[model samples]
Structures are given as C-alpha cells and as structure tokens.
Target: AQLNISGNVTIHRGSETLEDSKLVTELHNTEDNAYDIIVTENDDESSSSDEKEEDAKQIEPNRIEEAFQVKYQGTTLETFCSRLKLFHDEWYQQIKPYAPYLTIIQSSGSGKTRLVGELRTKGIYILYICERHECSSGYPASTPYVQKILETIRDYKFGALLSIAIKEIKNKNWSAEEFWNIQIKDDHKAECNDFWRSVFKSLLQQKKPSSDSRDENFVKKLFHKASIVCCIDEAHELLAKATKAKDDETYFVKWRRQIRDISWVGFFNILLSTSGKIGNFLPPVTQDTRSARSHDFVIFPAYLDVNTMDVLAPLAENVGKEYDYTRVVYLGIPLWGSLAQAGVSLINLVHLASQKIRNFSKKNNDHLANLACMACSLSLEVSPRIAEVDSLIASHMATALGVSLDRTSILCTYPSDPILASGALKGIIDVGWENCLDTLLELFSRGVVEAGERGELVNRILFSKAYADAVRECFPDSPVTYLQKVPLKLFLKSLLREEIDGLDELLNRMGIDEAEIGFNHWTSLLATNQKYVESGGMKFLTANLVIEAYHRHTAFKMPLGFPVIDHIIPFKYNAGYGIISIKTRIQKKTTFGAKDISSLIHPLNSFGKWKKGYKILGIYIDLGLDRENAVESKAELKSRNAPQTRSKNKNNEDKKDVKNDYDQIIYIQGVGSFKCCGKEISERLSKILFTRPWPLDTQWSEFDEKTDLKREDVIKTFLPLVFEQKQSLVDKWQLI
Candidate 1:
C-alpha cells in the first residue's frame, strides 16, 4: 500500500531517472524493436583478465540517495485538486461516450506544470505533453502523439502490477516521441495503434463500463476511478492558428479563417491549458466565448493569488508585510515573489513591478497603454481606484489574479471593491488580445457629472492617485495625451485639484496605496500661447465638450480638411463635458442629399472646419469666397497668404469650381480656414454645437474667452451690434 501511494511523486519535474532496464530488454526482444544506447566504461589501466572477469561476475553496484528541497506548496493545493476532481466527475465524465477534455487557463509562470506535479505527488498517472513540440505526430491528424499517450498508460499499468510507480525527472516519454515521430509510418499505423490499445486495455486500470446501461452517477464514478489524465502544456499553441474551434467559416470574424475545427478535439481524457484570458479563449458556440459550451470541458483558472504571496513571504505576519499584501498579490509573479523571499525591500519590489509592467505593455503591442493612461489620470486621489467589469471575468481576476476582496462582484466587477490591478486589459485594441471595453463604458458612465441621474462615484471614477507616478515612469506623458490614440475608449477626468478630493480624505478607503502619497495637480491642460501646453496635453473631453477642445486643438493644427478633424470635437453633451466625434458620409449620386446633410447632426460627425468657425451641423460647408476660397492644394492657400499672383493657364486639375448657388455664406474677413453653409443648413443647425453662434464674417477672435469663462458662459463682447450680412456668392466661383 505504501509503495503504491506516493510512488510516482518526484521531488521536481526534471528528475534524473533512466528508463527501466526491464522495459528496454522486453522491447529489444520484440520483433523489429530496439532501444536504449548503453556503453560500458573500462579503466585506463588494463586490469588483469581474472580481476575484470571477477568484477563483472560479482556485479559491482553503487547506491546513493539524492537530496531534494521541497519548495513551498501553496495553501490551495487541495483546492486545486478539488476543483479538477469536481470538473472531472461532474462534466468530464458526462461526455465520456464522446470526448473527455478540460481546459486549464493559467498565466505563464504561474506554476501550471508544478500543479500537475502536485497531482502526481498523490500517485495519479498524468502524461504531460509539451504541445508546442510534441503535439504534432508528423501525421495529418496526430496519430503518433495519440499512440504514445496509450503507451504511457501501459507503462503506468506495469508500475501498478509491481505496486511501485517509478518517478522520473523528465516531463514526458522522450523515447516514445522519437520512435513514434521517426519510425512509425502510415503502412504500420493500424498495427501500431492496435498493439498500443491492447496493451492499454490489459494494463491494471479502472475499466470504464459501457454507456448503454450505466447510469449517469455510475459513469461519473467510473471516470473518477480512472485516475489517468493527459495534460498538454501550452495547449493554447494548438489554438494559435485558429480563433474559434466550432461551426464557423473563419474561427472568428475578427480573426483569420481557414483553420482546423478543434471542436471535436477530445479523443481521450485531456487537459488543455493556457495562460491567456479565459473570456477570450473559450469558444462561444463551442467557439464564441460569450456562449461557450458550459456542459463541455471545464475552464480551470490557476491564478497566482494572495495564498501564493503568503507562501513566498511566510514571515509577513510577524513583520510589517501586511501593508505590501496587495502589491504582492497584484505583481507577485513567482519570479518577483522569489525576490521578496530573499528579503528584497518593498520599495525595490514596487519599482521592479512598475518597470516590468511598463516593458510588458510596450512589448505586447502596447495593449495596456490605455490602462496605464487611465491609472495616471486617477492617481491623484488618495484611495485605491475601483471599476466594474464583467462578472465572470471579474471572478477570474479575483480568484486567479487575486484582486477580489469578498470573492463575488459578478455584476460588473467581482467584489464591489476589487483589487486595483483590475483596470489593465487588452480589450480596446483591434489586433491585440482580449479587451475590457464594456468595463470602460461602465466606469465612464458612473463618472458622468453632467448626467442628471448622478450615479455612484458622482463625478469621479476612483483610482489610485499614486499610480500616476507609475504611469509617468512608464509613459512620461499627460493623462489626455492618448485620446485619439485610443480610438475605442474615450476616458475623461477632471484636472481641478480640490482639497476635498485629496488622498487624505480617502485614507479609510480601499487598500494598495502603500506609497500613501498625496498628489497635487501640477500639470495644466490648456494655455493661451503654444509655448505653454501642447494640444496633446489637454484634459480628455466627450462629444459635447468637443467644440471647445476642437478650437483649442485647432490653435495647433489649422484648416483640418474634410471628414472634419472635428472627431476631436464632440456633438453629444450627456457626459461630464460632451463626448466629441467625427463622421464620414457615403454620398448619394455624388449629390449632397438630405441624408448627407442629416449625417452631420451628431457633433462628432458634423462638418466644422476645426478650431475657428462655428461647430456646423446639417451640411458640408464648402466655403466659396474668392479672397477666402478654400483651395484644393495647401500650397495655393499658402501662396495666397503671401499675396502671390495667379497664373491664368496653370492647368491645375485641383481647382474646384463652386457653381451651385445657396442660401447663406458667412465669410469671416481674416480667418482663411473657416466653414459656411446655405440658409437651410444654417436653420437646421440653429446654433446648437457651439456655445454662442454669431453672423458670418465676425472676427474669429471676437467670441474667444480666456480664463474666468465657465466654459458654458457666453462672452459679452463690445461687438454686440449685429452686422448686416455681406458675403461672397457661390455661383461659378473658381477656387484655385
């Protein structure tokens, strides 16, 4: 009993164990079978023939015991076993008639291989295959890999017969891989598969009963009795070529097609593991994650959480390491945690963590760049920042990533006050990994101050103010520097440094702010001159607040051509400041139809020649005044600024003749790059997007307000007297 128990437990994965000599001998005796290259060493000095013969006859033997250091076994080792066993019993065996497979999603270096080692420590038979190298059997359908799997089962059966399961350091059956991949051919394939299957059936194993008469409970129990499991390391590599595995043309509409259908992959009891996002990997219709087969293989997330930190920092309770708990839980990858075990200071660890995260973000297509930016924007607050996310994903983050407080916040984020690391994800990018777009929408929705609903979080989305320092260390730019850079999520926050919103007020709040630094707003978003702040340095704004932002940015890049650069300007004003946007139109018969005119109502898409003029709605303002006619070529416009004479016969194909007559053309005298529209277009707009609308040709500088204007406050100017409309007509005006 003792020999059978813990028989297969190796001190570590890479143990130095030679193959059993008996198996090699037996295979050598088999027809066309040979293995094990062995060599005998002779002493340099030629020994006497009689002495050598005596030594060989006496069978000289050497024995030694190797010392092995047992690393920290996490507190959740039993939990790990329980989770896998439960999945195996309940769901894994339920489909035993078909295929039994489980997927374990774990981040890289989170001890996934070690966890399998732990199961082996209990004398469980596990065939670990490195998927990247060994999954392919050189056959079209991986016949050799599967054959080796059966052989591994037979080897275990031999161990059971002897009541002594041998433990080896090697992660897999290397000999099997060599023989199967190199020697096995299509001609002998059927014979080889038959031989392996017969050997597996005769092995001392728990025989699974026929499903015809066995009850569900009986079948599950039989599965539980069958302790053998095949775990493929880096199983996600099998999926790298494909997105979804099931009934789909392309695996994913967003990703590549022409991939294999892995939906019917479960040929035997298998465990597919990865270190990517669970929400992203599982197929929905067995491919789409949103509707992944719940009845299918279980998604076991082996996250490195606080228990891991406790294991690393055992004396954290006696010392003052409780304060650094959150930090370790968040950034305590095994490699970094080992540094903590060596008594590295918390400050050094934090600096190290910040650098690693930054470098990682930069390398992985900068998917986490927006997260870093959001962290910086919210870093001035004293308390830990929190945001809601999808409950299922949030649960994974909490347990696996160790970010949850109470273990359940399934609505948006798991645990109402989640671990601060919850904010970082790759969901926003088009070509990057999974994202958390909905999370951003949820957080921003609550942060809307202008909304009469006045949701929780009031005007602010709580975030660690000290994280701003981390962001600066990583990305060295202001909070709003990445607005257009992030085409997906438009995050906005206030820059006003109110004493009440200080970190000191949030001390009793969430944890993770071990630095406990109180920050003041030392950065300004806007200034009058270009010498002060750059256009990229402004605070983020939504569609409604975009006109002001458009004007500010226009001060930098004047005369932004069509498809109006007004995406920086927003038409919607529901969120705190207004969400700005830009739009493009599909023309009807090359004629500006009602649809074309109507497309501009949304402030983001409206035709506003950025910065100077009114945030025009309803129509494309094709300015048609000779002195200020918008030319097709920028060089011609520049030449006009210098008062260059026109060549009558320049053969300029770029010249657009403005022929159609319209209702109104509000031509500003000095402002060269401005927009004007017909009377119908003007009435449709009716002074909506901008703060205050005025007649055409008014000095672009007249409506400008610096400092004290509440932003919404209309400037009371000296030129209140309305000027009579005197504008250029659009009938046959040749603009060069």
Candidate 2:
C-alpha cells in the first residue's frame, strides 16, 4: 500500500514473533489537547497474590476529604437536614419576634445537642434544660440540680455551661453533693431559693450586646434578653416527680403547682416578647397531661426508634455478633417448655441467652472470653450480674431460639419478683417492686424488651402458649384450694416437688443420716421443702419434717409454745439470718420445726468459739428420769418433790395428751423481728415448753430439787392461741 510506517511496524528481523513485538514511530509533530489512547497487548506475568491483594486495598489519593456518612432514621444527614427547617429561618419566621417561645422535637441522640451548639454559635442566645442532670454516661449519677442553672449563663455558648455552673456553685459556697444527702435541711431551702431567683432573673432579662457595649454588663443584659429554651432531656423524670402527689400532701403539690405556674409565666413572657405581654404564660405540661402545644417547648428524651436502633445495632455488633431480631422470639425452651412460657421479646430473649454464656466465662475467670462474652452480652442487652437465678430462664430461651451461647449472652437477667411492675404482685413477690419499673423501662428503651402497656405485658409468649394454656386449664380440688386447713407439712412437700426436685430427692433419701445435722439447713430448704408438701403427693410431709424429728427428741420451751427456730450466730452478724428467716417463713409450708435446719441454722457456736466463750448454762436434755433433781424457784421447789403444774387427774390421761396429741416442741416468744437468734437457744426452749405439757392456768406442784421441775423452768404460764395455724404433715413434691 502507501507504506504507512506510523500505523504499524515490525521490530524483529525474524518472522517467528515479529507480530508480538511491534515498534512504530509517529510522523506528526503536534499533539492534540485531549486525546483517547487504546492498545491491546498480551497479558504479562501478574504480581504475587499477596502483593496484588495489598494493592487492591490501598486507598487512592483522590478519595480523601469525602464527607462521612451520617445515618438518621434510615435517611442521610443531608436528606434529613433538607426536610428540617433551618435554624435561622425557623427563628426568624416562627420564633425570633415572639421573644422566644420555640420548641424542637426529635428523638434522642439525633444531633439535637449539636444543633443547639450551632444555634449558640450563630448568636441565637438560648436557655437549655435537660430532663436528666446529665447524659446517661455522665457522672455523679443524677440530673444537675436547679441551683447549677442559676450560677452560669455566659458559658452556655462554650458548651462549658456545666463546668461554669460548678464554678458558680463553688463561688456561692454550695455543693451539688449536698442535694442528695440523707439529711436535707437549710441547704436545700437555700439552694431552692437561689435556683428560683436565678431562673426568674434569666427569664426576665432582655437585651443584646453591641460593639461599644460594656463587656460584663453587656453579656449579662444579653443573657437576660435571650429567649429561654428549657431543654429537658429524659423528660420522663420530671413527669414522674410531678405525678407522685399524695392525699393531704400539700407541700409537694404546692411546690409542683408553683413550678408549673412559674414556667407558664416565663413561657408567656417569651411568647409575648414583641407584644410585651408577660401575663399570658403557657401551662406547664407534666407527663400526666395527655397533650401540650409544642410551639415553644424543647424536649430530648431517651426514646426508641429504628434510627436509634440502627446506631445502637452497629455498636452492639462490635460488642458481639449480629443477630436477627426474629430469632429472639423463640429463645429458652427446656425449662420454660418454650419461648412462649418465658414471656420475653426476641431482643430480651437474646439478651438472656448471652448472659448465661458470660456467666460461665466470669466464673471460670477467663479474661478474654469473659471480656468477649461481656461485650456480647451487653450488645444483646444483658446486664453484668454474672450469676443470677435468671440464668435458668435465659438458658431455656437461648436453646429455644437456637442462638449460640456467646451470641445470646445478653438475654439473661435477674427474674424480677413481680412479673412487671403491677401492684397485683404485692405478697406474691417482695416489697420495693415499684422501683424496678424504671430499670425495666430503661431496658425497654435500650431495645431489650417492649415495656408493659398499662397493666399488661407488651409481648406474648410465642411457642409455649399451649403449655401455659394447659396450666390455666387445670383447677385445684376443693380440699387443695383450702390451703389453710391442710397440714402445713403436706402443703410444703407438694411445693417442693413442684419447685425444687434435687431437694425433694435428697429429703426423701435423707432418713437418719440427713437428720444428723439436726436440721441445720432448714431455712435453705424452706422454699424447696414447702413447695414439695403443697402440691399434694402424700400427707404428713411438712418442710419441718427434719426439725420435727429433732423436736421429738429434745425438751426446752418458750412462751408462745411453738418451736422457736433461732439463728445460731444471729442474722445481725451479717444480716444473713434476717434475710434467710424471712425467706424461710414465706417458703415454709408446715410449721417451722420440720424445715431443714442446716441451711436455716448456722453454727452460733462458730461465733462463740471464735469469741473463746463457752455456754453460761450447760446444754442438757430435760429428761423426766431426772425428776428428783428437778427444781423450780429456790423457794417453791424446796418445799415439795413433784412435777410443776401437775393435773388433778394425774392419771395416764394427761400424760397421753402430752405424749400422743402434742404437736409443738416448744413455744416461742419475742417482741421484735427475730432475724438474729440461734437454733440451740430456740431448740432448748422448745423442749422446756413441750416437756412439761403444762397449761397457763395450772399451778406448780413441786418446785424443789427432789421434784421433776428443774432450773430450766423460767416461765410459769402463757397463752395458747398464738401458736395456732394449719396442721398437716403431707409429703408431696412439685416441679417449679
């Protein structure tokens, strides 16, 4: 052709590979401003795999300074901002001239604080009041008291408002600490007065700073003129405090009313700023009030929503593994029968499951695993109580849900006494049940579980509904329904079978060997043994089976004529006895005598031995064989040689009543709550009271050394009605 060498050329002389090695030269002298170049060539040997992978991950220089992604309610920051009214535009059109009644509404953690910061930077002076004293993570554990607000204003612009407030507090010789002291006195009044004055002054001031304005005086004036936007974070706290008025409790009611009135007056002044009408303040909205206008109110509360959840999820994932929300619905199976019986939401279920895994890690002291499990558990919504009774429930939920132990760590938590915070749980659970509602709400807000609405739980059981239905389907017999007439022992045994199995088996197998301990642990066995008897397997099996055995063997007495189950070392030593005794009393199905003594009765001798002291009165049995040695008072017993309170019908009839019909071992008498007595003292007294089989109206026969009466006889007579209760010894078991 025309010999176009520029288009193509051959560099190799040989014909073997001249096509593969092309060499060409351009004939044109000028270059175009913009041109596209393309060429095809055979692939060369690639870089090593490791190097290639490294290069792939390397960030390019051009990608720097790109805007970070901001997620809010499943929307981008720019998108959200586009929809929200701009601060300046909003102030000018809706808030500015009103002298400052403005309300901002948004879920918590949604850039509200940042927005406030921006407004301050733009020279829009504001007053901020959060519901809580500080953020959840902030210290000293409560919202800042009203006193702090009165001391600082200028520093609000620097986001050092709290710090400045603290400084102001010190300047005024006050402390935030004093507010929470047990003894709140004059200091509280002073603080309240100071806070009131500060708030009043802040609301009333109305001026702006200028170039030639006196600096200190000008800031003060500007602060006064600024429209106050009392931002209440965790507004629920305020709402809660306002609703707790009692009948005839005018002080708190008056105080709350006054506060509302003040807030209303201030709000009206700001609303009528341009019109200069200070009389028309808005009414304060407590949570009890269903509705309130938001024209000038600003609140940021801990509310749960998808966007907040999304932010929380990633953090949760970082702490643990990602879990599908649906999986939580079926958590816990073995013990609860299914997730339905557990009555927990999916998130809560996951949290409970995760808690169990963490518990093992903590018990074993595996630092890394512990940390991981802890993080995972927290991610799933489990708290830090490593080993709690809730583990049983949590483990069951986890098994049902099919979540791995590590992932489900968050589900397990203490099974609060009340099902929720319903007052219906009065005697069924413990006192102070209402205090847990706040914690429950916090858990709900954190996505642990849905809170109860009104009086009912928000979530229903998912799979074990049938099991629960079956339970509700069954009804107790008339005999069983009347729990009081039934022997307490029988009721307790049935309860044991239902609630505690191992104890039931052990108690069944106990025989004489278990009795060797003299029913020392009865308090511990109280719940288990009582439940065993209550469910109805057999009769004569009270929680007191073990203690009754001992009662039959010994002889000591007290005033009430019922066996006094006292602590050995006394609960006051560690307060354990009081807790144990109350727990035992509630759980005991039969009288106190038959309850397991080992658990209930610790060794007071342990304390005594440690104290290097021996018994002042040597421990002994009141056997009638020593009748001749018996004595009552030094005066009465010296005169005769016979048993005290002997009946006129001294035949076997009275002795038969003592031997055959007698139920109680000894009588008990004490004025205060007996959280701290010992078993030895109690048992000794029981024998004394039961041995003689004396009546309150009976008189002494012989109070001498030759008589049956001895020095152990202290009381002469007592009432019998105090010892009355259900009489039974039914032995049964129930699985709880």
Candidate 3:
C-alpha cells in the first residue's frame, strides 16, 4: 500500500503519535515545488516533554522564503488579500498616531504566521514574512535578535532580482544583502523597495516559466500594487524584552527602530502581531523597568467565549477529547487551541504569559471551594462578560477567525475587559447552574486532591484560579437575586440558622490548621451522604452528642467537620441535589416531627409543596444520644417502621410529605468515632471510615434495604425513593 501522508498529524502531546496513518515522513522531493511545506524540528530549552509544536506543524523548506499553509486556501485568503489591498493605506491614515503600521495585535497561534505565509501563496507582490520569530526560546535564544534578522535577510533572493532589475532580465541572481544594505536602509527605502519589486516580478516569471507573455502581464499587475504588508510575527515577545541600556541601543530597541523604519514608508504597512487579553500598549522601555536588570513577563489569562468555543469545538474533538467549561477553564488560555491540537495538558502554560497574576502554584482552599459551591447554589445562570465591538477593528479580527465580521455584531472574548481586536463575540447565552455545579464537583474531587506522599488522608485540593474563574464564568455574577425571597424569608424563620448575604460575610480567614482542613473536607464528603440528628429536649445531651461527633472525627484522624447542614452551617451547601437542615433542642418524637422535617426543605415553597428552585436529595437528621431501645421494639425484627416497608402508597396522608417531597431520608446517632485513638494509627487509613461513622453504641436504621449500609462499625438508616440516585453516598457520587 502506498503511504499517503496528509499534513495533519494526530499528535498525542509529549508523545508524538500520527493520525490513523500518521507518520512524520520527510519529503526528500522538495526540489520541484516553489511553495514547499516541509516539516523540521527545532531544539527547545524547556523540558523534554515540550516541543516547538506550534511552528513544528509546518515550516518553510527554505527558512528565508516564508511559506504559509493554505488553511484559508481559496475564499478566505482571497478575501483577506483583496481587503488588505483596498484598505492598507486607509487604515494607516485613519490612525491618530499615524505610524502607518497595520498593527494587527493577534494572540498567539491565532494564525498570524499563517496569514503572512498565505500572502505569498496569493502571489501578493510586496509582502515579507520575517523569519525572526520573537519566541526565541530554544537554541535560538542565544542568538542576538539583530544578528538573526541579518542572517535571515542575508538568505533572501535579493541577488536574483538585483541582476534582473539593475542590469537586465537575466538568470543570474544574487542575495539582496550583497548589493543593497537592508541592515542600514530598512526594507522599504525607495531604492530598497524597487529591488524587492524586481524580486517579486522575477519570482512570478519563474512561476510560469513557459508562459512568458502571461507572466509579464501578471507580474506587471502584482508589482505595480500600491501597498506592501511587512508582517513582523511575535512582535510582542520582542517588545517585552526591551531594555534601556545607556551606552547603546539594546537588541530590542534596535528591532523596534527597524519596525518604525519599515512603517515610515508610505507604501508599506506593518502588522504588529501578539496575543492575550491585551490592554493598552506602553513603550517598551518604561521608566519603572529601565533601571531593572531583570523583568518578569508572565500572565495567565484564561478566558473563553461560548460562541468562540464553537469555532474551536470541531478542532478539539478531532484531537480525541471534547472540552467542556471545566476543560475550557484550564485549557482556555492563549495558544490553548494549539495546545489542545497537540494533546498537551500543561496547566502551567499560563504562568509564562505575564507576571501580573498569582504565583501559579496550586493548593487546597476549602473556603474558595465553598464560595464557588455557595454561589452556584444561589444562581441559575452565569452572566457572560462580553467584549465591546469596535466596528472597524472587530470586523477585521472576525476575518482571522474565519467569521463574517459585521460592524454591529461579533463574538466578544473573555480576556477582553477592554475589547480591542480579540477572540470576542457578542451574543445572549446562559451557562446553566447544573453544569456549573458539575464542573465545580469535578474540579474539587476529594480523591484528586490529597497529601503529597502515599496517601496522607487529604492533600491539597485542586482549587485554583481555573476553578474560581469557572465559578465566575459559569455561575451568575450575583445571586440569582431575581429569585423570590419568600422561601428565603421562610428559610430564615428557623431561629437556629444565621443569614449570610454573600461570600464576603461567609469567608472566615485565609489559612487554617490541618485539623480544620480535614474537618472541612470530611464535612463536604458526608454532606453528600450521611445521617442527621434528633433527640428529646435534652439540650446539654444534644450539645455534648454533636460535640462528640466532631471529636470522634478529630480522634479518627479523618477529614473533620461537624454533622450540621454544611459541616457546621444550617444551610444548603449546594442547591438542588443538596442536603440542608437546622439543628435544635426540640422535643423529638419516635419519628422526626413535621417541624423538624421542614428543616430539610427550607427554601421551600408556600403551597406546602417543595417547589423551590433547588431539589432535595434527602433529610439528614442526627439524633444525638438517642439510644436504640431494642428491648421495647416489636418482635418481628423487620416489623419496625423502617421507611420503605412502612410506606408504599404515596397517597397515605401522613407519609405523603416524606414520600413525595424528598428523594431519600437518613437517620443516625451522634458522637462516636472518638474510639479510634491515635486515629486508627495505620500507614494509610481508608477514608471509607469517614462516611461509616460509629455511634457511642451510636446507631443506624434502614428503609428499602436496597440502598442501606450494614457495616459493623457504622449504623445507616436510609430510605431511598429513587433507587438509582438514592444509593449509598460514595457509590452515587462515584467517590470511589
């Protein structure tokens, strides 16, 4: 079988894998083609796992002859060319500072390089794609910028055009560096401009070697073109490297002068390309940084537009993974599209962007996770931050994204607080609360966040800028404040719980001890699946019992937290699919009373129907100090009022409330595990014990035996109305 190699390779990040027939084969047949798309490897200074994957996709056979991949082969490329030819001069003239530079500040991997290369394929006359890539990280990092530029220029076909223009149309051509000094004159000086025109004309003639007459006409039209676009790719990388040395111009400043010189020519326009949520540009040698010997250029601005996501959705799927809001959060930064293409998952990529963000090191933040969870509980949809459209520039930016740019409408990007030209879009879209909650849970998975060694019970959690950004991007900006406060008003009726307007009041402090840390973690786990409390008006007994539950967890050396609604609070930790209730020293019936039951359904509806926005998983009541009087029980061991056995008919008046309103109901005794002294001193104790709390002769009861636990050390009383959803906690949530 003939091995046909398509240009696109299905690369698996650090491990290079070919698409089905993916192979990196070198074309030993580059001699015949004018636009040679050859693949080459560049040495990278980073870890072995990383490569110059972006440029490695395709490199020009001849480094000096910048070739573009015809990604927008025909229609898109043609439109861009026609537009550039028409507006290059007009765009320059309209600018206030009038630098005559096209100034296209594109983000990384948005195909600015491809745009440069495509101009060549279109047979544009005066276009030049500089090979001096500003991302000089690999072996090229050691080479001076000016020296590199000189070397690349030294390779151009100026010599060929000089022989044809200055003398006659002969086959003998020489390098431009030999005859005209571009190092001194810049690219667009009067004499230098004419020399490059001859190069383009000759190249065109060579393109159609046999059709001399047709070549002559085509050459005339292309050469006589009024505009020239000099694409200085990765110019932002150079701007940041700018230094203010006293004696002479630093390489960065020298490069800046070259750009300025190129822009001064009336016929020439320079497109300054870079990427990110770029704000206003400042002079490279700002006074504040002038005296500094070293500077930090790091920024981790990860933002996403749902509309913009559509543009990249297909590309992401092709790489064997589909990105959701959570993926977008961690992988949505600049070059994220390309990184996804390469199948890499380096979260630290954002660290190298700008020094203005956080330390980039990740750690657990229970408070942050709770804040995110709470916000999600309170809101139904996230209000997206849309970038403003600058009628003119946005349209042009749209062209890059292969979208029809309209003066009135476009996709605004997330990084764009001050939208200029970006991956921006304008539209109305809602991020549902369910998805946000799911993303939050996926991010803060207790299993994923843990101690550094071989199981330390609980290590740092995966609560980072990514998760918080998602909370901001996915959840509504404010509490779904439009929500009717009547339920909240009634929810507030319970004198035992306090009010928390927002996160500001909810936040405690920055840091806490590992004891509290484990407590909070355990609390989150149990809240998902565990029991609640109730007893006679035995105030001191109940208090001691609840305290004992806390002490038991601390003694067991497990992630610690109270058995209250949320570890220690009497509110919903997560809305709908959440467990909420209040604790008090009220008279306890053999079964929980209606008042006690209402605690589980607070934020409930007025019609006695549980019609609040959120859904109830079940009621968790901890009947601290309530000893199970087996001697006084019925003789039919199974005849006891176990939830499921007692109620099959939802129509039963008294049972209707529990059956129709709740998904599950769980009951338990408070305060036990303190028995595991020195915390069950094991090499790596299983957290399975966290959910399986033992009573001081503490206990568990049961409903439909299908979903109840009967561990020797634990007592579980479970009534699951819905078989699938109402399983034991760990299994339902996939905690294992």
Per-prediction TM-score, please?
0.33, 0.21, 0.32
Stretches of candidate 3 exceeding 4 Å from the true structure: 1-95, 102-112, 115-227, 236-245, 250-281, 284-310, 315-736
Residue-level lDDT of model 3, residues 464-544, one tens digit each, is 111222233333443211111112122221211223232121121111101110111112221212333232221111223
Candidate number that wins on TM-score, 1 or 3: 1
Q: Which stretches of candidate 2 lie over 4 Å from their true place?
A: 1-88, 94-145, 148-230, 235-306, 312-736
| Candidate 1 residue-wise lDDT, 1-736, digit = tens | 1112111121111212233111122212223432223332322132233321111101101100000112544665676666566655544344442223445544333445555545645445554444433322211123334434433333333222111111121222233232233222345556545544443444435463223221323322323433544455544444432324455322222111111111211112334443334443333233444333433333333233323433444423344311223333223234334444444434343333332323323233342343342232222111122322222222223224332333222121112111113222111221221222222332333331112111111111211222222333334443211111111111111111122232322221212122211111111123224433355433323333343332221111112232332222222221222222223221112543344333443333432323322332221322222222333311010001122344334775454443212211111111122122223322222211111223222333344654332322233333343432233233336443
- Residue 375 Cα positional deviation in candidate 3, in Å, after optimal superposition: 17
Per-residue alpha-carbon lDDT of candidate 2 for residues 1-736, written as tens digits (9 for 90 to 100):
1223433233322212223223344322224422222243423222233321111001111111010112212333343233222432343343432222222222212333333323332223333344333322211123334334322321121123322332333345432223222112222545544654553444335243212211223233324433223343333333222224453222222222222222111121011011111111222233222322333433211111112112212221223222122322221112111222333333222222332333222123232223223222111223422222123222211111112223212223221111110111111111111222333333333333422121111000100111122222232421111001112123222212123223334323322112111110111112224455477422222223322322211111111111322221111111111111111121123542323332222223222122121111111111121233332211000111122353446454543223211111211112011112123322332222223223321234456545645322233223223433243223222332
Question: For model 2, what is the error of residue 304's alpha carbon versus the real structure, in angstroms, after optimal superposition?
Answer: 11
Indicate the residue-level lDDT of 339 in model 1: 41
What lDDT score is found at residue 216 in candidate 3?
23
Relative to the unseen true structure, what is the C-alpha lDDT of residue 439 in candidate 2, on a scale of 0 to 100?
30
The Cα local distance difference test for each model comes to 0.29, 0.24, 0.28
Sort by TM-score, best first: what order?
1, 3, 2
Error of 3 at 54 (Å): 15
